[model samples]
Target chain A: MWKRDEKKPVVGIFGFSGCAGDQLAILHMEDSTVDFFTSADIKFFHMAQSHQEVPEVDVAVIEGSINTERQLKELKEIREMAGVVVALGTCACYGGIQYLGDDEETFKERMKYVYGKSGETPEFLDLVGQPKPAQPISDFIDVDIMIPGCPVSEENFVPIYTKLISGLLPQKYPMPVCVECKYEGNDCFLLHGKFCLGPVTAAGCNATCPSLDISCVGCFGTYEGANYPSMIDKLKEIGLSEEDAIRKLKMFGGNKVEQALKGD
Target chain B: MKTYKMPKNVFPDFIELIKTKGKLFGPVKQKSKYSFEEIKNLQELDFDYQRTIMGVKKFLTPPKYKTLTFDKEGTKDIIDEPETNIVIGVHPCDIHAVKILDRLFLGNIKDPYYASKRENLIIIGHSCLPDDKCLCQSTGTDMVEDGFDLFLTELADNYLVWVGSDKGLSLTIAAGELLTEEISDEDIQEYVRWQQKRSSMFKTVMPSFKYMADIITLNYDSEAWEQFGEKCLSCGTCSLVCPTCNCFNVDDKILMNAEGGFRERMLDSCTLPYYSMVAGDHDFRPDRTTRLKLYYTHKLKEYIGRWGQPGCVGCGRCVTYCPVDINVITVSEALFGEVCETKEVCE
Candidate 1:
């Protein structure tokens, strides 16, 4: 470890297969972006900077989930090198929308549909090991922190970032988005006969979707210790099919939701 | 209370006068709905609006605000009071809501943040036609007695204005701009006639629980809550749209335990699932039915006990906005006629 750059902690940003939406959110933070940049010496960020050398970093903020062996190996290396590992989007922490094909067999079938026969790998595609269903980084390496969101909320991310830079541990979110929705004075979409996942899902985006008159698609994943079965039951009672309810629950949560259901 | 006669043609001049005093916020059309927005241009005012989606509570007790901004070594107060301003085209139902909020925020707690906005406010109420969804009359909030600075009733050729308080007299009308005559006896007659017309316009909700406080209190074990909870999304929209809902939650974020952090209070709704969740995850009201009952009890019974009036101002925003057709009127009707009976009758 290079102990010389003590003033600013060396940070790295990495992305795998999922959409780069969460990283864009970090870039979109106009007010706190400067503070974040000044506080952390970004050593590896292929999306934002030109530097290609994957130098060891003090803090590694990894976005997206691992669907292939190459990403899995890279994630293991990151966990070994970085002092702190933060799984920054829903994909990194859970298994985001990319985790739709829940079963390994289904995942392979879907992959086959996207990329023909497995024997021939395209020039653009690089696969080091056999592909599997999308999975959270924690499925392989130990994650120090998990800040989940389809695109992580700046309201939640900025404050937590401030603490992380100060060498302080940010508090884990145990509350649901319903709390923030109440504070926002937004009408309940579920009450409106729309399928809303706010009650069982996490908060911290200031209930942005509901505020704009749209139902939450569980972009933040289920809240810690949330009653997922009850939520699914309620969703069905309100007209959402069991299949649809489970789909909505797993949209941002992926394998994490399955793990939660199995009491993991 | 003084009275003034403003000709139909020069209403804009009076608007200009109010604008000069401070910021002018009035009813304006937003898409298919209506909203109370800042009137930068005089022509943006849409006095013909029935209701706004958000209540004026946004002015006095805003949803999100900062209480303190501090670094570890020091602290700074960030409760910036809004500028003095006039809220035009307020309905009597909404005015009563503002009164309830005053009682909630200013009476017992004396919230400095709320007081900062409440003190600088100038309310201008107007006559409105009740729609099918409006039930303000049923709740005794259809017409306010003394909250506004000015009250306007539109007539054929002129707008009959009632100067409610000394603040209303602050405006000086130009010689030719105003009628410059005593408000005629015809003015009073026409105003009273409109009051009678407005009183008769409302269609009374059936099975009306005149003593709502007692009805809700007695039905502690009512199954109506279960039925309602089945339809309840627990999104807390009812409380958020409610002019009388004054629940708030405060949280502190201290930076590294070094530099001072900040404290913030945000609008909270009782209907939300986690409203009563405590440390170690002991939820006071875990189910939607219990949460719904808590809201109804607070609005109909508890608030009445504390403030001598029912919390619900009968604005019908909940009814108009509810996706499952869960209006208070239908619920009250159901409670009295059928659902609120004991298990014997319910079974």
Candidate 2:
């Protein structure tokens, strides 16, 4: 539950190491950008036009996941200072694409690939431990609300933010994008022999890809009731193999698809 | 509303009558697929086709349109128009899509651009006679009861037109002498039978939209997502073909002189790594797996809960178009469970 104040709820938008598309999306809300700024008392939004001190917030919206040691500490501090913490995008809600290398060895290999042979690592104050696999904010801290989008859709973000400012908890959305795609009357991509991920992806985007003469690539992650095996089987029947199917499932979904396949 | 049964020869006469008012646009053959375009000849219309490659929304919110233009003097101009156009041969699913867009653009803030186009366009829908890939019946969107000026159901040799709105009634009157005032109960009943039979052709039926939400939430930590992500190429083909993916990127394209430029907005997908990039060079979704998961969860679970409807229409386009073959229904059923006792359609 959220409580509204006369001066507008204290809102903070923070980000970690991932792409800033989610924050950029906020900037892309050109029509409502001024309204959003005027309506909410933004305490911290690092990616936007300002970079002010982080203050106590009623609702702290965090983007990206905890991938580094510093991110872990900052997230903990954010949790301590905010009344409610919301995961703003797929990165925060489901670890985004950075968590692909879930295995410790693979993660280290990739890190080494990028960081080079640095025998001496830089030291910093408040450094805690070695970085673990990237995990959604919920895996580290309690997330009151999870806004899941590759970059959160203005359709979902605006209303949720307004409700939070007004002291009302935004209602959760449950349908998949396929439903909207059907309503749009576009031809089914599958029938035309095109692969799509709409059946399993969530629906805040209003099935944008299908409307544009393309198929959903499952950017928003899995819906609550995704039927993974059936989807895979259908893919195989239509000329894909089980191996290819698994690879596609884990592209954005990560270990979630692995567990579902094993009936875990 | 009056109904008339035009003879076979009167088909050309009806086309002539409608063409006299304005340009007639219907499903036209483009390579292998059907597209809605202006029709100058009756033979060009492909009424018996399966479905159009794209929805009728392009008429309202086109893929690329200028929202605002600015000059050196800080002068900004917004482009909007109120024009009259007629769209024909729209399938039931497309008509439903128009209604959804209406709810999105008009139901909420009343988007001036979309509203203007919506108000100016006249929609004529055709009842879908089930195809092998359609599952609209299960999704509750197979019929064209509303959101159209008129609806036509194709019979054996003639077409039964149901005038739904004042615009449709006006169109009917304009083509008056060609139409008949008498329509039989048998004709309507036969049309209904044809529709029901058409629905039976679909192979896949998803679970209730409510159940879909539960499946995604309960299995957040499921392994299926990771497996799918591994094989996913992250090419963004799925989102591009999705009918309801409305995410876009806005860029200010400056002219050579730098005095003025128009702000250009283009479609974007979360599946792309750069989709979430910020000014500080931080890329939020760095891998393909996370991008894939974001799309699935949003479509099946989150958006449905917000809008009170399933996001997918059971169109098999994603599965068909995906180069990597990441079928959404397969993943959804694998997480939730297959629709039991229902015969599999895709086999």
Candidate 3:
């Protein structure tokens, strides 16, 4: 994955089925965008650049989740060519919204709603193969770091990005979003009878949603050792069914919720 | 105290005069909530607004600010002290909140960043109409004896103003032609009547407010916290809006070159699970219930010990804003031995 250029780190930005929201987060870095682009040599970023060549880059910031066989193949190739892979958003980190599926059969059945006549198109199968249940980059490749957010906030991304470019191993804070929300002084959504996944969700976004009085949707993956069973009990106490709470927990990433569902 | 009377109609021109002095901020009605924002038009200032969505503590301590900046060049202080800014139409609870914040930020080491902003600040307090959500009256925060630059009490045709500081006197003198002689005895009586009326408007009270510190300490391992934690988003909303919760975190952001970046300040919350987490992920308050308990303990017990004042001024923002309705009053009552039947509010 080592590139010819020895001066600056060559970077490639990629996306898959999920909304390119995490990449869009890069654009929202208005204060640091110029410095970011100037510091890193962009090898391939189809979202921002016109001409693209997927040359071996030092690092790749991959957004979205792997859903199709073609995407899986592309992901493996990316892993082969990139030295360090950073999962750039909730989708790439937690399988995005596709994690809502409880099983493979249900995942395919839900795909029918998207593709329209899922079994009818031979052309689709020939090019992309069968759609798979969404999974994080860690499932397919050796991910070096994971930055989770719906559209990653600058405060979270900038520090991590700076660390990567500085050749330092990025440190991950396993705190929940409540850490940031408390700092910003946001009101608890659960108190207002709104279902917020903040208590169990990973911290980073500086509690963006709650600052503006919006409930956190757990766009960031679940916190480290997140107590999902307790969160489910919380949702139940707040008037949501256990199934509904589990479904909402699986809204972003299923790894933790799946474990909780299996009584982990 | 020097008193002046301004006709209700001349209030608009008087506001325009205040604008020339500095950036004027007042309560602006947004959909269902009111916020302290730049007052562009006189009509935007609500004379009888209920409460602002957030407390006035935010003005003293911003959400994000640069404390220091370091580079290969040199390290230097970069605290951006603001110019003279006026926050008009402040409610009594928030005025009391500012006072609590002042005791914290200005009490000990004297935070230079907070002092810089506080020095340039001017408060214009408004006597507002009370609603069911307001508990400031019952809590003795219905009126501020001091701390405001100018306090306005509206009468039928004019506003009864009390100049609390030299800054208030200057503002009052600036409105030379707009100002009249001392408020009439009838107007003073009207102000007194409004005070009584506001005092009678409180619908909710934390029965344990008087002995909150002792009550919270006595119930260190209360089961009610576990119940509230079961429904807690742990978003730290209570601490943020408490006005007295001034905890902060500082981080140094270095540029890739390791040459330069700013050391910035961010808000920190005790209610967060990570607030007590140590090295090697040794979380002291790993559970949500534990964290929530610590937050209440700080506000009610620890803070009261630190300063003579009780942390909560009964602004009731936490109750009004809690999405799931874990009221402080009800929770405190439960902590102090009252088995509450009502799950939502404590009356």
Q: Which candidate is the best by lDDT?
A: 3
Q: Mark the regions of model 2 whose C-alpha exceeds 4 Å error after superposition.
A: A1-264, B1-8, B76-78, B207-210, B277-284, B338-347
**Candidate 3: where is the Cα deviation over 4 Å?**
A1-37, A41-60, A67-84, A100-131, A140-144, A150-156, A168-249, A257-263, B68-72, B254-260, B338-347
Candidate closer to the true structure by lDDT (higher is better), 1 or 3: 3
| lDDT (Cα, tens digit) per residue for candidate 1, span B1-347 | 66678888988777777887778898888655667789999788898877777788877777777888876346677766658878999988898998888877788678888888887888988988888778887787887767788888788778877777667766534324564557788877987888788778887543254577777766667778888877665656677777778788776564322234677777777776667888897989977788888888888778778888888888888887654555577667666656335755432
| Winner of 1 and 2 under TM-score | 1
Best by DockQ: 3
Instruction: Give the DockQ of candidate 1.
Output: 0.23
Arrange candidates by DockQ, highest first: which order?
A: 3, 1, 2
| CAPRI band for model 1 | acceptable
Model 2 reaches what TM-score against the true structure?
0.55
Tell me the tens digit of each residue's lDDT in model 3 across B1-347.
88889898998888889999998998888655667888888878775677665667667887668888776667889666757889998877888888888887788688889888888889999877767777665466777878899998877788878898999999999999898886677887887887788667677755557777776776677789988877765655566666667887777676644346778886666765577877887889887788878777876678679876667777778767654566566677678664444655434
Model 2 superposed RMSD (Cα): 12.7
Ranking of all candidate structures by their TM-score, best first: 3, 1, 2
Model 2 residue B329 CA deviation (Å) reads 2.0
Per-model TM-score versus the true fold? 0.81, 0.55, 0.82
